[model samples]
Target: MTSRPGGRSARVREAVLDAVYAELIHRGYLGMTVENVADRAGVHKTTVYRRWGTVDVLIADALDHTRETDWPVPDTGTIEGDLTAIATEIADTFTDPERRQVPAAIVAAALQSTRALQAKQAFYTARHTEAAKVVTRAVERGELPPQTDPLELVRLTCAPLYYRIFVSGEPVDRTTAERAVQSALAAARTGLL
Candidate 1:
């Protein structure tokens, strides 16, 4: 669906996605409903159903919409600074009670629906692509080897954070973010990533 910026359709989409986000955080994928989103968005239920067709599809679209506001590559002068910034950005999300639920729900939804899976993949792909630019800059600065894999470094940096929250059920804190930065930096320096 095409929504011109600042148009009524854009406003409606924004409202629906806002409601979807809140529902994902509070109700999760299985519990989130189009009716609930419509109610929260103050729109007719048929509007959401007609546009997205299913809860999973609506959730996917909502998640996809988040990319515009999500992860940004830091332009700090050093690779260490950039990695730390990136890790901190991720850590902050996991540490925030409200923000954390979104990722958790997305992961859970991906396991159950193809649309959610695609959304999850697209979300990370965009994030990784943006974050990889930091490493690409570092390579140009001679901080990393010319052959360094930017996305590999990006993935390594994020892997532990994801594992900590999703698998180990551990708290994601500033220290956790720092450790990931250290590990990924070491790996990048050693050409291990």
Candidate 2:
């Protein structure tokens, strides 16, 4: 059957994804269920079951929907400014209590489910590709070598913040964000990245 972009199916998908995100944020992966999601979405259990089948699929679909959403890449006219903006965005996100739960839940779900893991990987891959535009611009402007890997630079700028937040349990503020940007930029400038 042919699909309409803004028809009933689209509306149902959006509602279900929104409900999944809310469920993940409030109840997390462990507490969330397919019935709860369907009820929260105002849809029948069978509809959700036929479309999503399971909580992991629901969460993965939510992540995929989120990945497809528009994310404005920073354009500050300088690599440092752009990368700092990117890193700062990450810091701000995880530092917030409610917003942090979404990704934390994604990570937790990924550990237990291959579907969630693939979704998480695809989400980051899309984000990295989009964020790498700044590094590409930097190369164009002669700020970095043409051989520099934009994805690597983007990954480097984001790695330390994730490490601190998920591993070392350290605080990540604007200072930490800027530091990560600087280190990544330095590595790129030195032909290390």
Candidate 3:
């Protein structure tokens, strides 16, 4: 639809994305269908077929869009603060009822499908790209070693939170998030990164 201003196409796209997200959250990736999404979005099935053509592409598009809107990296002054903010954001993502299930489903879908996996990787790559700035800021401030790998550090910082959700299935809270921040900070301070 090109995202042009004041267009019904944009509205329809938004509705389709909204329907896609709701379906992913409530029914999961496998349960998601173009017919169901079209019905949910109040559009014709042919419209969905003509626009996206498949559930895989629609799920990937919806996921990529969510990553653009959500998962913003915080620019708190210190590395610890930044890491803490990142961890908190991750925790909130897992715990927030409005968001929790869909991501879990997306992650699972990523494990099952190449298309979903590429979309997940792209979303994480973009998130880490923004988050890398925090590590760069820390290095610039002399808080980190000059050779620190920003994206690697960002991955380490997020891994625990993802583990909690995708592996342990444990509840993530502020305290859990803080522990992850502290652990990463400790390792970082020791030049382990």
Candidate 4:
């Protein structure tokens, strides 16, 4: 089907993203090409080139799409509950083989590409913003103390999960997620966060 103007652009973008992600998973970043993505998405090479201009732009766009669809921070009324929910969501993402590989690949790419670094920053910024909203709400509701630092709380809540996923290359199971949540809560309660 031919793409329209407004909504069709988004559809084309999604198709390109899906194609790029598939190529990334199957062949890694070094092997990914606009021509291959266009072929996979059933579009011409010119279409991909015209839209994204470069491979880095396409990769960045794909990463942004992946994060938007997959990462969702939860709000559960209380700080502890909200954090547990967020931890569970994070654990689930890290444990998913496909999802985990995407971030791993992106990190490798980010090391060499400034565009990749910007994309990673944007993804984390979105997550941090969502988390900040949750923490801010908790403070307003008296679930957390007024002096609580939202950014620090977010770091405390997510650091362990990232550590396990990236450093140890371990699966983030429910038990581990719960432990992280508990540890963060303990520190938060003690006014350390």
Top-scoring candidate (lDDT): 2
Displacement of the residue 27 alpha carbon in candidate 1, Å: 4.2
Model 2: per-residue Cα lDDT over 1-193, one tens digit each: 5476888999899999999988877887678999999999999999999988988888888999999999999999999999999999889988887788788888877887899999999999999999999999999999999999999999999999999988999999999999999999899999877
Evaluation by TM-score, superior candidate among 1 and 2 = 2
TM-scores of the models, in the order given = 0.89, 0.92, 0.86, 0.82
TM-score of 1: 0.89
Global fold similarity of model 4 (TM-score)? 0.82
- Stretches off by above 4 angstroms in model 3 are 1-3, 6-11, 26-31, 67-71
- Per-residue lDDT of model 4, residues 134-153, tens digit only: 88988899877788888888
Off by over 4 Å in 2: 1-6
Better of 2 and 3 by lDDT: 2
Candidate 3 has what TM-score?
A: 0.86
* lDDT (Cα, 0-100) at 59 in candidate 2: 83
Which RMSD values do the candidates have, in order?
2.7, 2.2, 2.7, 2.9
lDDT of each: 0.86, 0.91, 0.83, 0.81
Error of 1 at 145 (Å): 1.2
Scored against the true structure, residue 67 in model 3 reaches a CA lDDT of 77
Q: Please, what are the lDDT tens digits per residue for candidate 1 over residues 100-185? A: 77877788778878999999999889888988999999999999988999999998888899898888888888899999989888
Scored by TM-score, the top model is 2
Scored by Cα lDDT, where does model 3 land? 0.83
Which residue pairs of candidate 1 clash?
none
Worst 10 residues of 1 by lDDT: 1-10
